[model samples]
Target: MKIGRIETFYVPPRWLFVRVESDDGAVGWGEASLEGHAEAVDGAFEALRDRFIGHDPRRIEDIWQVSYRGGFYRGGPVLMSALAGLEQSLWDLKGKVVGLPAWEMLGGRVRDKIRAYAWIGGDRPSEIADAAKVRRDQGFSAVKMNATAELDWIGTPRLFDEVVKRVEAAQATGMDVGLDFHGRVHRPMAKQLAKVLEPLGLLFIEEPLLSENPDGLRQIAELTSTPIALGERLFSRWDFKPFFEMGAVDIIQPDLSHAGGILECRKIAAMAETYDIAVAPHCPLGPLALASCLQLAACTPNVAIQEMSLGIHYNVGHDLLEFCSDQQVLTPEDGYLRIPQGPGLGITIDEDAVREAHKERHRWRNPVWRHSDGSFAEW
Candidate 1:
């Protein structure tokens, strides 16, 4: 069927959803939320619609190639994220027409359920022990928290004692803790923090330094045994190749929405598998984004754990399940989400809720943080 129309919705708490329709009345949905840059990603769709309106919706790979190669300047967050949503919706539409789930078409099921981890402490972590206890009571065995609020270039060793104490408190609740540096730490402090936190037995340390600093990452990886998890920012397999080649990263956390969609990440995961690196798709958006992540986890063997945004700080008025019609598809049971078996992405959206929410279109932006001296800091 020919692609008849493409529609987009700006849902609350910062999410962008795409709906694709075929000439003969087939429909599919996907998320292209780039968090703070939703407008840029939405603007990207103008070019996509101009290129692929009358094209065959079933030829997903062909569409993807044309979308990428046809555009001379491509492969940034905005372009790739827009293509990711379109590609995901094409797969969803094809799967629905054929009466099969996205995973079955990819390969087959590798596991019945994939373990899920949720966010506990807020950006500037506090009361982590109690937060960990709450997550434990909710049946989550693991939780991720920010390592520090906003760090300067170089801090004293005493700056890390509180960080260590927070992790220890979380661990005391019988939970695995993943400390997220959030790319806020500079290389100097990242090295020191990695060294100090190595003894805590953390599940992983995310973005020890931003992926842009590969040399710094390699240095930090050599200094500590803690797994260096990154790639929430890197948008393509080409972007992730250097880390794999350098043996700098132990775990790759590609966000399905950000890193070119489901199939691209599957390829990236396969590349990581050759390096013996684990996969943990980064997903902190809404339901559609989480469903896309689940589809990837269902077929990919290297995926270690899934990062979900159930009660994350971003979802202020709207939570994960608020717009989801079939909540079971995205809900965690005992810290793991079952592989969705229904057609396409396997989760249904509440169209009414989405349409209503779109009317109010949230202009969500991440907070900008500055150090005590008025210099810019990564937030």
Candidate 2:
């Protein structure tokens, strides 16, 4: 069947969902939420619709290639995210028609279940520990939090002490804690923080200096034993190649929605596999994005842990499984998300809720932070 209609909805709490319908009445759904840029992502689908409206729905890779290369500009958050949603929907549509899950189509099941981690507030030490305890009560064994809110070039000795204290409190709750530097820490402080936090048994330190600072990342990797995880900003396999070659990273956290679609991440995971590195698909978006990660986790053996957006600070009024009709499908059980066996992405979308939410289109943007001296600070 050929692609008939491609629709995009701007759901509440900063998420962009795509619904693809084929001429033969087949349907599939995917999420392309590039938080803070939902409107831009929605605008991106105009070109995709113009290019692939009458194209064969089964030609997944062909559509992906044309979408990426056809536009010589290529690879960025906006373009890749838009293509990622379209590509994921295509996989979902094809799997539904074939009566098998997307993972089965890729290869087969490599693992029965993948571990999941939730986000917690890390700006305050005591509060974060409380948040971690709450997550532990919710059946999560691991939780990730920002290392600091908005760090300057260098921090005080007290700042370091607070970081250690927060992690210690979380660990006391019998939860594995991963500190996200969030690209807010500059190079000078990144190395120092990494060295200090090295003693704690952290799951990983995400975005130690952002993916753009490969040289800085290599330096941080040399200074500490903590698994340096990154790649949420990098959009394609090409962007991931340098990190693998340099051996600057221990685990790669590619966002399924940001780094091309499912198959592209599978390829990236395979590349990381050769380097003996682990894959932890970075997903802090909607159910469709998490489902895409699960599909990747099912077939790719290197995926170590998955990130879910349940109870994350971003989901103010709406939560991760809110728009999903089958909430239990992606729910975490004992800190691990079971591999889905149903067709397509193995999660159902509440289209009516999505349509209604789209009525007051969300204009979500990340907060901009500045240092005490009025200079811009990464947030």
Candidate 3:
């Protein structure tokens, strides 16, 4: 029952998977993929291993507390992500030991399935109409796409017509569209963009302005009735509290792997529930991360929709199900992902495939974009 070893595998398409083993032969898996910074997150595990080795694996919360508070310097992407992976593995271990799914341990499920969404257009979106149709054919009722690419600080209103056109094209396919400004829009543009896109009845506008500018976000929220979804960058409940308090956001999209793991996100969801906000986790990573998100969705009532990485543009050579043994557990049906009934995170990892893929670990980095004037733009 004591934690024996902790190992991290850098897998394909930019993912870091952690494997935790107990002295008594229990094994648990978690993902700590921090997109472009997998190595930093992987490096963070060095301290986690030092702290958690020989400790009780079943003490999930204690491990989390120590990992976070004991570090003295905590709550950033790298440290929290590393802690998140370890925390998820501990839950996986404890769930398997008890012969119950993680959700069952987390007060059972509130829904049998959650509505799921897929990414339509690539980072620099184009031809979204066709992509939306493809997603509809794939049984997804909703799709998200970048609203614009590398926008200038203060562009003309005409720049948004194409955005409206793309959204119209997707909505033409009878699919709900969520336009992600991707924090590429500054305040001047965000207000205009949010005002213009308000008529489309979007599912949400994600990161119209980055979380750093809460005042800007609040202003955009006031400008439009569209559900302002953010928190992909905000890592914890402390980070998310102000948005809820200020009425700045309608939906919180905490990334399970980047935020603190399952329990932490569940707590965040509970916090959002008080504000009557919805939860739609941001998961553009691989299987383990998606499975971790599903676990949260299974138990939390506030979770409205789920985002999956299946066929997302970032999954270059390897897709979401590459290293998963039972893809059906994570697959979408009728535009919803069924609650995983299996113990732990509910999907089995193909360990051999993971180990094999680790040999050729990917050095994936998000594309860097520049404005027409050569100033750096958010990607």
lDDT of all predictions: 0.89, 0.91, 0.90
* lDDT of candidate 3 over 1-379, digit per residue (tens): 7999999999988999999999999999999999899889999999988888999999898888888899678798999899889988888888888989999999998889999999987432346777887888877999999988856678886788778888988998899999899899889988988888888999999999889999999998998999999999988889999999999999999999989999999999999999999999999888989989989998899999999978645488677997989989988889999999999998899999999999987888888988888888888
True lDDT of residue 353, candidate 1:
93
In model 1, the worst 10-residue window by lDDT is: 120-129
Q: Tens digits of per-residue lDDT for model 2 on 157-224?
A: 88898889989888988899999988989999988889899999899999989787899999999999
Tens digit per residue, CA lDDT, model 1, 88-131: 88888888999999999999899999998888774323588888
What TM-scores do the predictions have?
Answer: 0.97, 0.98, 0.97
Return the candidate ranking by lDDT, descending: 2, 3, 1
lDDT-superior candidate, 2 or 3: 2
**TM-score, cand. 1:** 0.97
TM-score of 3: 0.97
Alpha carbon lDDT of residue 338, candidate 2?
95
RMSD each, Å? 1.4, 1.1, 1.4
Give stretches of model 2 more than 4 Å off: none
